[model samples]
Target: MQHDFLKNYKHKTKESRRLYSRAVKVFPGGVSHNIRYFEPYPFFVSGAKGKQLSDVDGNKYTDYWMGHWALILGHSPKVVVNALAEQAKNGILYGTVNGVSVELAETIKKLMPRAEMMRFSSTGSEATMYAIRLARARTGRRIVAKAIGGWHGFNTALMQTVNYPFEEEEGLGLVQDEGQFVESIPFNNLDASLKVLETVKDDLACIIIEPVLGGAGCVPPIDGYLQGLEEFAKKNGSLFILDEIVTGFRLSLHGAASIYGLEPDLFTLGKIAGGGMPIGILCGDKDIMSLADPVARADKESLCAIGGGTFSANPMTMTAGLLTLNFLKENKQQVYSKIDRLGRMARKGLTKLFAESGIPCQVTGEGSMFLTHFSKNVVMDATDIANSNRELLKAYHLALMANHGIFFLPTKMAALSFAHEEGDIKKLLEATKKIIIDSKLFKRFA
Candidate 1:
């Protein structure tokens, strides 16, 4: 059955097969990013619009991956595209400070007031890397703590214990001493996490974590888990940082901090903030953020020394981000209400469907994102996620793509965009039901 599905995928994506053949000659694993390459090669996208992705082979699938969960308004919303076209006519990169960048910053500050000051970077990795640096500088401490399965980005310093088998070395090329000052704690287990923090409390610089764990699994933190960590950091004289790159604007306009009542000393934002363009923002209190002020410090020794790259705050990104935020701000009620409602429907429908078929599974996520864990046990952390039936989940996602026109990035989390509606959810449910009935793979899971 697995072989049959692979054959079906190959038959549908012949052009993609040819393109991937050429890609491997230049790129590692036939792709720039590791996740983009999956079993039997990934389909090359020709274009995308709204909630649909059209591949080079003319196969269209309702895009649940949603540009790594960045496109909340969906592919090419006219509001952003039209304004971006005009902005492009003026300039894309000035390589210097611009007014539009200031406007965008002001807009973000107005929306999320905790961001008294901010600096823009081209990627979330840069934002998170800088966040830790600022914490170390502020407290004059050395150690940083992160959740076991939390993924901040590819930054070398925070790369410890990101994948499964949390105790093992992440991979080659990372120096042994690089992770010396970093500590990992289990997610959702506040007592165990606090015990680990106690060991390095004196030298702890910061506690950086994702409010909702992405990449590792779409697991939401249990109640009071985040708040307890924050309280510990506060008492231990360490800065508390929230890596909201995935949960920032997606959960709500105010970000997850507001929803969870967290007052982090420093926080990072990316993904949806970019508005389908590339952007990364590090926001914090005025006093802490001012450490990066070159003019105020006057010397390299006195400053934190963090800023954006050449592409940071380019006019194109600033324009698109500003437009997207503006649209969301104006229609905030409509946008959040619709997307959250859809998220509830997806979770509930899937839970009931799986139960009826005698399949043991748990659907995990908050707001508009979700993932299925093929396990009877409750999933609360990365260890539980690692123990789940990942192979079966991958096969299920593959079947959805090959036999049905639904798209999920294999076993990764799926996010519903504002462009998706009730009809789209119905279609997805229908497809899942058909796959459950027709595929012989479900028998083993049952």
Candidate 2:
């Protein structure tokens, strides 16, 4: 069955195969980002509009991956494209301070007041790296505690335990000592996490975490879990940093921090905040954020040393982001209501469908993000996800792409944007049913 699907995928993606053949010569694995590569070569997208991606092969797909789950308004929303087109006429990158950047920041602050003071950067990795650095600088401590499978990004300092086989090093080129100052805690297990935090409390600079475990799995926090960590960090004199790069504007207009009632000393924002453009925002309390202020510090040692890169606050991103935020702000009730409804529909529908077919699986998610784990056991953490039938899940996602026109970036969570509708969710459920009935892939796990 897998062979048949692979053949079908290969048949449809011949042009993509040719392009990937050339891409391998230029890129490390014929793809820029690692996850973009899949079991068979990934189909190269030619264009995207609304909830669909048009591939080079002339095949169209309902793109649930949604630009790494960024495009909350979906691809090329006319409002953003129109603004960007005019902004492009003016300039793409200013390499200096600009008014649009200030408006964008003000817009963010208006929506998320916790962004009392913020700095723009080119990527979420930089924002998170700077976040921890600011924590250490502020508290005069070296230790950073993150959940065992919490993915903060590829930055060196926080690259402690991102993947399964949590004890092993992430990869070569990252030294062991680089992670000596970092500690791993169990997510959703407050008591155990607190026990881990107790040992390093004295020297702990911060406890950085994602409200919803994004990349490790779409595992939402159990009750009191996040609050417990926040209290611990506060009492231990450690900064509680929320890495909301994936959750910031995606989860809510204010962010997951607001949803959880968290007062993070520092938090990182990306994805939907950028409105499909490249951006990362480090935002927090003004007193703590002031550590990175260059004018006030006046000396290198006094400053925390974080800044927006060359492309940071570029006019294009600023324009798109500002417009997107404004759109969301004006129509937030409608936007979130629709997407969240669709998300719940997908989760409930999929769970029921799998159960009716005698397939034991668990769907984990919150709001508009979700991932399916082929396990009868309750999936509460990354270890549970790792133990689940991942190959089957991957095959299911692959079959969706090959036999159906739905795209999931194989094995990654799916996000419903404002562009996604009830019809799209119905389509997804129907296609999933067809795949399960046609392929009988779930029987292996059953």
Q: 266-330 in candidate 2: lDDT tens per residue?
A: 89998887888999999998998998889999899899999788899999988888999999999
lDDT of each: 0.93, 0.91
Give lDDT tens digits, candidate 1, residues 27-106.
Answer: 98899888888888999999999999999999999999999999999999999999999999998899999998899889
Clashing residue pairs for model 2 = none
Clashes of each: 0, 0
